[model samples]
Target: MMKESVQADASALDGPALFATMSSMRAMRRLKPDAVPDETLEQLIQAAVWGPSGGNMQCYEYVVVTDRDMMARLAPLWKRCVDSYLATTGKYAPAGMDEAAYGRMVAAIEYQRDHFAETPALIIPCYRFPEPRIDEEGLIASAQALGPAGTEHLMNTQTRFQALAEGSCVYPGVQNLLLAARGLGLAANITIWHLMLEQEWKETLGIPEDMRTFAAVPVGWPQGNFGPVRRRPVADVIHRDRW
Candidate 1:
């Protein structure tokens, strides 16, 4: 049964302000296999839906997966992605990232990939589109209509537009979910590398290829604690009114 509180806006939940929970939200990749109650899961979903959407038409939806067998099935796909990334990239560290820290992060993600089946809940967040957004034929048409240079620009625009649209519609909800989970003392993380095998994964989930999946989020109790996260100072990344 669904909880009454889930129906109410998370803002009026009579607890901490949802916005304040952001600082505590961290990507908790290492999780325990303990089961999470549905009512609690309901809170996360409710909070996710409260996120802002264009014209108030909330198009984001989530598929909550808790069965370990299903996760086990995804393990090989996840491994393929991780191995591909590690092999192609040579080094996992991004520019300006400390080699040691990035190495540790890579190791942790590798561990997460290896033990994905142990995760308690796998949330697949998607952007439900009305029609084909990334059709190859459409790109070819655009390429012919506009010159090749212009076609590249057109295609870039299309990709950017879709990404921006989906990001605007889906990421806020994902943020809300992370915050909600944090408030409830649960841990979660989002990964998109698995999309390398998107076709097969979508088939496994019974989701149509046309519907775009934004990312896969796994939620569970953490084996590690959420501590103060390190990041570049605001002064470094923040731009004033004019850069």
Candidate 2:
């Protein structure tokens, strides 16, 4: 598909309209089979490229899959990943979320697992740089130094900061794409459960072994409506000088 460029005024690109789009860009799972226009897709990617990368070294690659046969080949593996992910981690709900909310979340995941093959565009965001690996020696040992949950807390902190540093290079692009698609009334999903079959996918798609497949974003027109999403108050999330 030929990517098209969109000409937008500078104000529109950075104004409150962008904020509204960003806030409303929900994770769309049950996407329609209707194909996203190449122009829109291109625009989204263009927006993505505008995102900041670490040291301005943007080492990221995107594989946009639109072929139906490839989708068919991938869907079964996607379903398998979904099943594995749910069986192991889905039962663990996050803080402040109810059981009903967790169930709905699982249902949405299952929806994509079942219908990902029918998707119009399957965009894989890859880190062209090296993938990070957690070493056992890097973990904090609390009992060796501090008491209580200090070790656990320290380990969690280290992992989070490490992942954040790595993800900061790629997810900015992903977020830009999401906001751009939302502004254009396109539905897109962020799916990564397929990592379970990462090797098979890489072999089939001929992706380089060193490149990290960070996310699989499937884009299309929505089977649902845009949202006025729920979020916590700014005061609750923000800290002025300290946490």
lDDT of each: 0.78, 0.78
Most accurate candidate by TM-score:
1
Kindly give the stretch of ten consecutive residues in candidate 2 with the minimal lDDT sum. Answer: 1-10
Candidate 1 local Cα displacement, residue 37, angstroms = 1.2
Residues 22-118 of candidate 1: C-alpha lDDT, one tens digit per residue: 5446688888889999888889999899999865777777888887788888888888888888888735556666678677788888878888888
Minimal lDDT window, size 10, model 1: 1-10
Q: What is the RMSD, in Å, between candidate 1 and the native fold over all Cα?
A: 9.4
Using all chains and alpha carbons, the TM-scores for the candidates as numbered come to 0.79, 0.77
lDDT score for candidate 2 against the true structure: 0.78
lDDT of 2 by residue, 116-227 (tens): 8899998888886555554665444425566657766866697687567768988999988888888888888777776878998888788998887888888888888976
Residue pair clashes in candidate 2: none
